[model samples]
Target: MDLKPLLNKLENYHTEKPNRVFTMYLNTDPADPDQQGGEWRLQLKNGLNNFETYLQEDGDSDEKRNYWAVKEKVQHYINENERNLKKSVIIIATADEDIWFAETLQMPVKTEFFWEEQPQLRQLKELQKSFPKTGIILTQKDQVKYIDAELGTVKDTALYELDLDTEDWRQHQGPHRADSNLGSGGAKTSKKDELAERFEANRARWYKSIAPELDQIAKKHHWERIYLVGPSDEVNDLEQHMNKKVEGKINKNLLDHEETKVLNEVV
Candidate 1:
């Protein structure tokens, strides 16, 4: 598809609110219900009037309409306050598999990381060493505490908050629990329950893990807003919990794209 029109729309959208950072999340997973998996694109706009027209003409569905609405709101906000758009930044997060597709399409690729088998602390340390400039750790809610400790000393290390519905956790838990029951049901259940209990017991650890990084981001960038986007149920739940803890410091939004699709959109 020709992305010029979309790009032009985004350009106009951005022009309107030059001060607010503009972040876009695209679902790249082939299995994502919302995404028609393909090459990703970024469209910068100073406003959304033209983009809204294009979306209407493109015949996006009701769900797509919601996406467009959010996009338009951001666009409109930018348009109304063009003077404030200078410090704005655009960030896109997606799956590792779609990174190639995004690169192949020549789309702008920001930071890229995937869920791995090792503990989040190890992963964070490795990532910090590699991308030393990175100040924010985007991860599943369950790993926040681990990530916090891993990069606590690093300057400007903050956790981006993402929300996943509780229902999604319930849906995934059946199979997760089933797998837990396999071979060593009792032992697995006990271990899993123990982990959950630990998460609950030391919830402050999770917040403290990224608190320093968040402060740095705010201080250095004068960043007043944060956008979290991800698939992990633990991450989503933790985001909600942290929002309460951090109070005015964090801004949380739940990305509605399916797990798979999230990669496509962000990557």
Candidate 2:
């Protein structure tokens, strides 16, 4: 999801009475130690119940009715999505449905609830800053894999391999699995070794060839940070040619790993 547009819209939103917004941030990660024994369920119930009790005691008729409507909707949403909840869940809505936004995010969030004229966005903004849109470039020899991610979740991915004949990078739909035998013990490595040898000879030029595409992808994805992970020489050579700044670099090949594993190890 693109946050720039959504955040801008939410930041300007305001209302009163019937349109009062309800904002919620729930930490639902089962692995989180604090959530052991399904404690978040009780927290959520208590939070909404507190709001209901307060509205019952002191709120005007419209305010109480609106709060009740929003409360029911919120309860239904949570129940429906409980099984699919991720590390966190965020929701902002009004009883009349003038505005509604809900998302299950891979990133963690502190549990909080608000009933106000505008959606509470401080935590969401913090998540955006902490886990901004990122492009992870993984390289080995003549292949490059790009993982586009935001808020700690993989968004999209593509593979690009340099065609020796054309000296041009060819985009592939998915990851290019690394050859398992390349570095295994006692295996004949003539073919791949020869290719790697050839690539090493003109490594600078080859890396330079793909650098422009990296910059292009970063621009297209609006990546705030770009990380390159691969052989030291590949990372250095590519950085020298690319206009985009490298946020981080790791001197090890990880293109063959699972997307989540690679992301955790690299960033």
Q: Write the per-residue lDDT of candidate 2 for residues 1-267, one digit (tens) a residue.
A: 777788999999999765589999999988999998888899999999988898878758898889889888888988899888889989898888877788887888999999999999999999898988989998877778899988888889898878777888888645455553233336556886776677789889988888887899999999999999998988999989999999999988788789878887766
Error of 2 at 191 (Å): 2.6
Candidate 1 residue-wise lDDT, 116-180, digit = tens = 12111232234334322212223333432111111112222222331222211111211122122
Pairs that collide, model 2: none
Candidate that scores best on lDDT: 2
Cα lDDT for residue 10, model 2? Answer: 93
Candidate 1 off by > 4 Å: 1-141, 145-189, 217-225, 230-267
Residue 64 local lDDT, model 1:
41
